[model samples]
Target: MTTPVEVRYFAAAAEAAGRGAEQVLLPAGTTVGGLLDLLAERHGPALRDVAARCALLVDGVLHRDRDAPVGAPTRVDVLPPFAGG
Candidate 1:
């Protein structure tokens, strides 16, 4: 089955994705890395480059581990490194 996930892109990630947010239908039990891969394929290489250094905020929790599995009806924030304190 497919799970619906809300993906929000910020800063450089937003620029790469050309949008601030989107709803993606992902396979059940999809890993963080898998999601990133799918996004790269959908958005192209620019997003791939930014996503490599980006951090994922899953359901309000910060996640850096790519192997982590994402659950359904989740909100994923793609955050790129920012300047300033």
Candidate 2:
């Protein structure tokens, strides 16, 4: 099995996902966009819609590049836009 990426969901994202976190296994050298795609596939349309409005933070750094690599044994936090923010 491939190394698991720690995925964390917050607020609306968490509610849509129906969970706070999960271990997602992806092959070596997967990117943020790839991860999002996989998450949308595994988590369903609710999550997919939530994901589009979410910001991704890898480890502690903001990642906007979907093609950017997601290192193994890492943490990816899913944060959606706040109501007023």
Maximum-lDDT candidate: 1
Clashes of each: 0, 0
Indicate the TM-score of model 1: 0.92
Cα lDDT tens digits for candidate 2, 21-55: 99988888788888888888988999999888777
Q: What is the C-alpha RMSD of each candidate to the true structure, in Å?
A: 1.4, 1.5
* Residue 8, candidate 1: alpha-carbon lDDT: 99
Off by over 4 Å in 1: none
lDDT of 1 by residue, 1-85 (tens): 9978899999999999999999999899888888899999999999999999888898988877899887764799998889951
RMSD (CA, angstroms), candidate 1? 1.4
Best by TM-score: 1
Tell me the lDDT of candidate 1: 0.89
